[model samples]
Target: MSEANKDLMEKYMKEVALRRKYHEQLVELKGNIRVLCRVKPVLKEDQQEEGQAVVVTTDPNNESALSVINKGKARAFELDKVFHPQATQEEVFQEIGPLVTSCIDGYHVCIFAYGQTGSGKTYTMEGSVENPGINQRALKHLFNEIEERKDMWSYTVNVSSVEIYNELLRDLLSKDGEKLDIKINPDGTGQLHVPGLRVTEVKGFQHIKKVLAKARRNRITFGTKMNQHSSRSHALLCITVHGTDLANGSKTTGKLNLVDLAGSERVWKSGAEGERLKEAQNINRSLLALGDVIQALRGNQTHIPFRNSRLTYLLQDSLGKGNKTAMVVQVSALESNVGETLCSLKFAQKVCRVELGPAHVTISFRMTRDAMPYKTSQR
Candidate 1:
C-alpha cells in the first residue's frame, strides 16, 4: 500500500472505532423512515357513481331491499396521478436497483409492500410472469454494478427466501415435494430445520433469477373471491451483501429484504371455505399482531410483545433496531373497496408514527497496522 493509502487506512480505522463506540450512545436515536402510498389505477367499469349518492336512511342495523346499482363501469385512471401513479409496474421494477445499492453503500434496508387482495402486491414484488419485477431488477443491478465497477469494488451476494404459513414458517426455496421446518435461535439468526430448503449463494443475475423462479413455483398461493390469484402466505426475499472497500479495507455487510404480505380480505367478501377460512384467519391474526407490535414500538413500551406472533418475532431484529425500513402502501382507487382501502390507509398512518433507531451498518476494518505475520521453519 502507498504511504497515502496507509494514512487513509489509519484514519478510517480510527473513524470506525469512534463510530462503533458512538453506536451504543445513538442506538436509541430514531431512524429515517418514510411511507410511499401508491394509488392503484381504478378500472373503467368500477367508476360508476351511486346515482343519487343514495340516502339509504333505513335502519341502524342494515340497508334492506333497496340497492343502488352503479350504472357504469370504473375506469383505471381515476386516481390522482399527479404524484401517485404507480411506476407502470415497469418503472417500479427499475426503482429497486438504487434501493439495494443504498444498502451496499452502508445502510441496513428493508423494503416491503402492503395492499388489499387483488390490488397488486405480487405484481410489485414479483412482477408479471412475462415481465421482471423489483426483486429481479435489484439483483440484476447488483451484479451489473459489480461487474461494471470491477475496479471500484467487489461484491458477494447470498439470497434466501421463506414464507410464514398460518403462523408457521416454511422455506420458499424448498424442493417441490419436500416440507421444511424453520428454526429460530435465541441469538436472532434463523435457519430452515429441513435440509430440503436450500439457501443458495448467487454470483450473477441469471443464477438468482433461476432460483427465484423455482421459489415462486413453490410459494403458497390460493384463490379467494377478492383475488383469483391471491397469495395465501407471506413471502420474504432477502439478499445479503458482502463487500470490501479495496482502497480502505473497509469491510461492509448489508442486507435487503423484500416482503410480500398475504392479501387482506374480509370473511364475508372472500366467501372462504374451510381451508381458505383457516388461511385467512392466520393471515389476519398475524397482521393484527404486527399492528400491535408496531403500536407498542411507537409507544416505546417496555414489553414489545414481538414474541406474541411468529411473524413479528422473526422481524424483531429488523424493525426499530437500526435497519433502514421502507414500506409502500398500495390501494385500489375504486370506491367499492373504500373500506379495505381505508383500513390500509389507517395501517399506513400507524406505520408512519412508528420511529426507528439510526440505521447501523457493520463495518469491519482490516488494516496493515492490525495485521501480524506468522513465519514457520521446519528442521
Candidate 2:
C-alpha cells in the first residue's frame, strides 16, 4: 500500500477501536422511555380575577408530581421529570441533551412534544430564532462532537422535514406541498421508506439552520381562536448521521427524529368550521391512533396497530422494537384550560409506562474506498 493509504488505514483502525469501546459502555447504561412535563406560566392576557387563580401547582414534597385544581377538586399526576413555569430554556435542554447525544453513539432516537392548543409545545421544541430551541441546540452539539472526533471517523449528515396534514404526508422541504407515500417492507428489519421525500445533505450547523428556515416557510401553520399562530399539521424533522471508521470501514447509521405534533384540541372547543373542522378531525384521529399505539406497547400486546395511521406507520421503526424515546408534555397553567391540561397529563402518564427493549447499535463493515457516503453540501 502507498504511504497515504497506510495512514488512512491507521485512522480507520483507531475509529473501529473507539466505536467498540463506546458500544460496550452504552450497553451498560440503562435506556428508559421517559416522559417530562413542562408547565408554561400564565400569560398576561390569561390572568384572571382573584377568585379565578391559576389552577396548576407543583408539589413541594415531590418534584415530579403536579396538581391541577378545577372546580374545587384537585388531581395529581407524576412523571419522570417536571419543569415548573419558571424554568428557563437552558434548564429544559439540560435534561434532554443526553438523549440527543445518544444518536452519536449509534442509537435511533425520537423526541416528541405533545400538548393541547395554546399550550407551549411549539415554544419548547422550536423557540424564537434569537434564543434557539432543543432542535437547534441538539444540532449544534452533534456537529461539535463530530468535529472533535474527525481524526478517527468521518460523518455524513442528511436532513428531511415533512408534515402530516389532513392525514396525508407532505414534504416540507419541497417547493410545493408535495405528497409522499409511506412504504413498509416485510423484510423483518422494520424499515420504512418515503420514496420522493427531499433529503438535503447538510455540512454543518449553519447549513442546517438555512434548511430549517426554508422548511419552516413551507410548514403548515394558521391562526386559531386558542392561539394566534397554531401549527395546523404534525411536523417531523429527521436527521440521519452516517459515521465511518477511516481504517477498517466499520460503519454506523443513526437516525434522530425530532417531532412537533400539532396541538390536540376538541373541535367544538376550538370553534372549528368547514376547512378548520376537517383539519381538526384529522389531527385528532391521528393523535388518537398514536395514543393507541402507545397503549398497546405498554400492554405488551401481541400485535401493534402501527398501520392505523400514516403518522404512526411512518414512525413504526423509531418507536417500535429497539429504539430510545423521550416525550415532553407541555401544559397550560390557566384555570380555564384545566380540562385540556388534565387530558394531556393523563396521555403523558400513559406514555411513561410503555417500554421497548434496550437500544441496540447499528454497525456494519465495508471496503474503505467504496463506502460511498453522501457528500454534505448546501441546498
Candidate 3:
C-alpha cells in the first residue's frame, strides 16, 4: 500500500478504537427521556346563523372544545391539561426547553416529534416558512443562551439532516437520484453520496434559518383528510454542540436531536391509494418498528431489533441505548381524531420509561482529509 493509503488506514483504525470506547462508556449514562404533547389550534364555527349577532358566552382562556364539552375529560389516555393543547409552537418550546436545557447543562438529551397522520407533527417541528417551527425556535434560544454566557464560555455547533425511506437514506438536498445508502463512519461522521443531497455547516442562526427555509420547501408533502399538506417523510435535524468554559476550561460536548417523524396513517382512514398507499404502508411499517424498539428498550431486552427498520436503526444511538431522549407527542383537539389522539399519547408515555445514559456530543474539531471525533458536555 502507498504511504497515503497507510495514513488513511491508521486514521480508520483510530476511529474504530474511539467508537468502541465511547460505546463502553455509554453504559454509564442515565438519561431523562421525557415526551411532551402539544394541542392543535381551533376556530369557533362561523356564527352558525349567518346574519345573527353572535354572543360568545365562554371564557377566552377556557379549556379546549373537548375539555369544555367532555366535562374536562377526554378519551385520550395521556391527555394533559396542565399544558394547553392549542398552545403555539413557541409555547410548546418554552414548556420543553427547560427540561432539555437541564440535560444539556450536563446530561444527554434527545428530543423528537411524533404523532398520527395529519395531527400536526410537521407544524410543531418544522412549521410553515412564514412562521418558524420548533427547530428554528430552539436554535435561536441556544444561541441566545450562548451569547448571555459569553464571558464564561465559547461554543461551536454543527448540524446535519437526513431522510430515511424504505430502509434507505434519501438525501432531501440531493438533485441526482431518488435515494442512497448512508454509512455511519466509526469516527461518528455520517457519509452520504446521493447526487443532490448535501450537508452544510452552519456558523450562525441566519445561515441555519436560510437552510431550514430551503429544507421546508423541499420537505416531502402529500394530501390527506387530516391535513392537506401532511408530511410524507420523516426528518432528523441534529445539532451537535461543543462548549468550553472560559472560566474553568472544562470542555463539554453535547447533542440535541430534534426529529420530525412522518405522521402515521391508515389506508382506510386516510383513503390512501396508489403511491399514497405505498407511502402509508412504508410509514406504518417503520413506526411499528420504532414502537417495537421502544418496547424492547423499556423491558431492558438484550436485542433491540433496531435493524428491522431504517428509522429505528438510524435512531439507535440516540434512543436511550446511548443518547438521552425526549419525545413531544402532538395531537389535534378536534373530536374527529380521538382514536389517533389516544394512540399518540400512549406512545409518548411508553417513551418516557426508557433509560438513557450520559451522552457525549459528537462534533468535528478540525479536518485535514476527513472526520475527527471530539467530545463535549452531558446536558
Candidate 4:
C-alpha cells in the first residue's frame, strides 16, 4: 500500500475509535435503555383521501418530541429520538449504529421494533432489498469493524434465528422446524440456552445474506383487514461476537439481538377469527408480557416476569441489567389509526423511563456456552 493511503487509513481508524469511545460514555451516562419513535406515511392501501388529516405530528425544532390526537385531545410524548415519515433507512440506522458496533467491544446490545398492526415495524427492522434496514445494516457494520481491527483482534461471529409463534419457539434455521426449548445454564451462570438450535458461523456478508433470506422465508405472515402481510410471529436474529485480543491473549464475547416483534393488533378492527384469532391472541399476550416485564424493571420490582411468555423468556439476557437496549416504536400518522397510535406512543413513553443500568464489557479466557447459546450446525 502507498504511504499516503496508509496514513489516511490510520487517521480514519483513529477517528472511528474516538467516536466509539465518546458514544460509549454518552450511552453510559444516559443509562442503557433507549426509546425512539418513527412515524410512517400513509400508504395507498390506507384508502385515505388526498387531503385527509394526519393525527400524528412532529416538532421540527425538537427531534425527540411527538404529539398525537386522541379523543380530540392532543397528547405529547418525549423519547430519545424521533424519525419522520420521510426519514430514510440509512438515517434511521445511523443513530443506532454505535449500539450495533459495540458488540465488538464486548457489550451486549438488543434492538427491537414495536407498534400496532401495519405500523411499519417490520419495515423498520427489516427493510426492502434496495434499502436494507437495521438487521442488514448491523451485520455489515460489525463485519466492517472486524476488518478494521483485524490487526489486533481475531473475531468469530455466530448467527441464529428463531420465531415465537402461538407461544411456541421454532428454530427458523433448522430444516426440521422443530419446537425448541429454552434451558437455564447448568453451570449456574443464570443464562438461558436453546438446545439443538442451529447456529451458523458467519465469515462474510454473503453468508449473512443467505441466512437472513432463509429466516425471512421461514417466518410466518398472513393477511388481515389492517395489514395484508402482517407478521404473525415475533422473530429474533441473534448475532454473537467472540473476540480474542492477540496482543494480550485475552478474550471477550458480546451479543447483538435484532428483534422484529409481531405488531400488536386490535381484534375488532382486524376482524380476526379462527386460526388467525389464535395467532392474534398469542401475539397480544406475549407483547403484554413484555410490557409487564418492562414495567417491573422500571419499578425495580423483586421479580421480573420473564417466564410469562416465550418472547420475554428468550430475551431475558439482553433485556436485563448490564446490557445496552434500544426500542423503535413505529406509529402510523393516519387519523383512523389514532387510537392504536396513542396506545403505541403511551407504551413507548413507558419504555423511555426504564433504565437498565450501565453496560459492561466481558473479558475472560473461558468461552461461555451462553455466548454461542446454540448448537453449531453443518452448512
TM-score of 1: 0.68
Clashing pairs in 4: none
Q: Per-residue alpha-carbon lDDT of model 4 for 1-379, expressed as tens digits?
A: 7999879877876775697688789777765777889999778888556766788999999999999887788998998899998999999998788887777888888898998868888888889889899998999999999998898789999999997778888888876567899999898998899989999999988889999988776654222322434377788999999999765688989999998888775674558678778777888889889888776766667898998899889989877767888889999998878888888888888767555343232333225534665745622
Better of 1 and 2 by TM-score: 2
Error of 1 at 65 (Å): 37
- How do the residues 91-133 of candidate 3 rate in per-residue lDDT, one tens digit apiece? 7776556544543454445666778756667777778778767
Candidate 3 segments exceeding 4 Å error: 1-31, 44-76, 79-82, 99-108, 128-131, 175-178, 184-197, 220-230, 245-250, 268-274, 298-301, 350-379
Instruction: Kindly list the per-residue Cα lDDT of model 1 for residues 260-367, writing each as its tens digit.
Output: 888776665658688668878888888778777666665566887777776776666655545556566677655476667667766766655445332232112334
Full ranking by lDDT: 4, 2, 1, 3
- Predictions in order: lDDT: 0.62, 0.79, 0.60, 0.82
Q: How accurate is candidate 3 locally (lDDT)?
A: 0.60
- What's the TM-score of every candidate structure? 0.68, 0.81, 0.66, 0.83
Clashing pairs in 2: 12-246, 12-247
Error of 4 at 336 (Å): 1.1
Query: What's the CA error at residue 194 for candidate 3, in Å?
Result: 11
Deviation of model 3 at 11, angstroms: 39
Q: After superposition, how far is residue 266 of candidate 4 from its true place, in Å?
A: 2.1
Report the number of the highest-TM-score candidate. Answer: 4
